[model samples]
Target: MTNILTRPGLKPARPFFSSGPCAKPPGWSADKLAVDSLGRSHRSKIGKQRLNYCIDLMRDALSLPDTHRIGIVPGSDTGAYEMAMWTMLGARPVTALAWESFGEGWVTDAVKQLRIDPVVMRADYGRLPDLGAVDWSHDVLFTWNGTTSGVRVPNGDWIAPDRAGLSFADATSAVFAYDLPWDRIDVATFSWQKVLGGEGAHGVLILGPRAVERLESYTPAWPLPKVFRLVSKGKLAEGVFLGETINTPSMLAVEDAIWSLEWARSLGQGGLIARSDANAAALDRIVEQRDWLGHLAPDPASRSRTSVCLTVAGADEALIKRMAALLEAEGAAYDIAGYRDAPPGLRIWCGATVDTGDIEALGPWLDWAYAQAKHAN
Candidate 1:
């Protein structure tokens, strides 16, 4: 840490780094949006095509398998995940693992709301639960990335190859930013808002063959809400997975999602993941040089390349809040505050839309902000 106190003069060109509703893609503007779909029914001939376009492009960007089903669903990622739990779980003994806030919420849903006596496993904020200890004979549910903690499962090597149970992943923050072992997961859910920088209130659900089989073959005992029901009268509602959404959708938001997918496709070879990885690397260089700041995730491999969370030594949640406020007031940063439920620190989004150059600019500003906070003390 440098003792000399001169604030960095250069500010990040685009300072919007909120973890959710992340920054828009390069060259993005309201004008690039598909205005034609506005005022049109989402199920209309044109509207359906727009929706299908989003599905198509999303699959292409993710390089999903041919057998997997990708569908648009209501209530964002939360809706899709709840639907999976309501419809597919309870058919088998369940294992629920939570490392942070969102993951913990799902575990609560499984045990409390759904009233399923799941085998619960948990880890404190900066660590991962013992994946090897989970019994695969029981259906399992977890988040691939702990968004609030900025810790992600390193890989899918821990999953048993011949496991009998289904694996449901809440991948809202992991899909585009990290490599997901698709074959290992039976069902996965994500919102358009996270890595892709699209509009919210809509979610993308991906189901593998096993997941579909579970929906088709098993009948859960609990009655499901209309919004969470994926099966009707002993069968999966095929139309919902075919772009005929269960409810009316925002065509404008649909268009925005489509455009973002197209932009990802335009990146050609490495696409969004490449850009995101580069941004994380840039920020990492900044963190390595400072002894005062370090990753919240103890292990380097577990650190998220998307949500770059940092913990400053001797800083309490209150002190971190003051520093975040100082950064926001300076116009050099915005929405980079840590998750409210998380230990106090800072979280910067390094998704594809965020320029590595902006991350580089943020380095000196972080230093300046820390200095100011220290001086205040």
Candidate 2:
């Protein structure tokens, strides 16, 4: 056991481990970002060029198929997802799956706001509901990875290839960290802040051919605000997918995303996934060695590689807070506490942008903080 009186001799070089707006790519600095698009209208020729370039780079990095269309939207992942729910649902029987706080939010939207009367499936944190039980005839909404719960579907094998209804995935934290089967997904939404470690308030919405067909053919009973409108005068808005945004976007944020996307392009999808896997493996080694620390998600196959959650022995809200504060004050880690809505524990970001060395170094500091908090209590 680590002694409470002895502080760890080593510290992580970069202590940022927040789940959202996660640690920036290694060696990132504001001076490195391009500023040519700043102080200019997003509708200008150069603005559209930069925006389109960003989309192209993302597509290249993810190897997204040409059969799908990608667009930049005003709201973060939430905005993009809500846009999908408001427009594409209700045309068919709907099913909403919830395993964590964000997933629950989607259920609320489907049930209360949209009043779609979706067949709801739910599981407690750290476990996934039965994928086999899902109805293929109903439009299904689910998160590819549960950010707060640290649980994820193992693969896309469960989705029906010939299903009549569309599949909407909230992939905010899963994209770029895992290999996503694009054919299984019809509509996907994410924010640059998660896996890419870029700015927030901007969202990326991807639409497969089926999703586009629904947008053009089906009309919802609810009134859509201009930002959520993807169709105009009975035709798909080609401009939105091509670089013309529904609303004004933050050019600085777009530039920041482009910088990260360029970094991702250099690494390639395999390299990015490798970095995330290595970081998660390093963290796993630390957890395996300590009997007091156990994964919140026990099953290895369904565990999240990006946002990994752990349960501390005899931990409660106060103890977890004390440990987090001690670590932060010692410059060992920041924002390592569990999500507010989750069970008391520690949530670490092991995404592609985080260095494996930092995660390896975090072990001793976590021991020191845990010991200190226990001794104090």
TM-score of each: 0.97, 0.99
Tens digits of per-residue lDDT, candidate 1, 1-377, equal 43437768788999888898989888889998878879888878888888887888888888888888998989999999998899899888999999899989998898889998899999988899998899999999988988899999889988777889999999988988877788898999999899999989998889999998999899888887877767777777877877889888888888888888888889842777899999999989998989988899979888888988898877887788778888899888898878999988899999998998999999888888888887887
**Best candidate, TM-score:** 2
Deviating ranges (above 4 Å) for candidate 1: 1-5
**Worst 10 contiguous positions by lDDT, candidate 2:** 1-10
Per-residue alpha-carbon lDDT of model 2 for 226-290, expressed as tens digits?
Answer: 89999989888999998899999999999999999999999999999999999999999999999
Cα lDDT of candidate 2 equals 0.95
lDDT of 2 at 184: 98
Residue 317 accuracy (lDDT) in model 2:
96
Cα deviation in Å at residue 361, candidate 2?
0.3
For model 1 the TM-score comes to 0.97
Q: Each candidate's lDDT (Cα)?
A: 0.87, 0.95
Model 2 per-residue lDDT at 50: 94
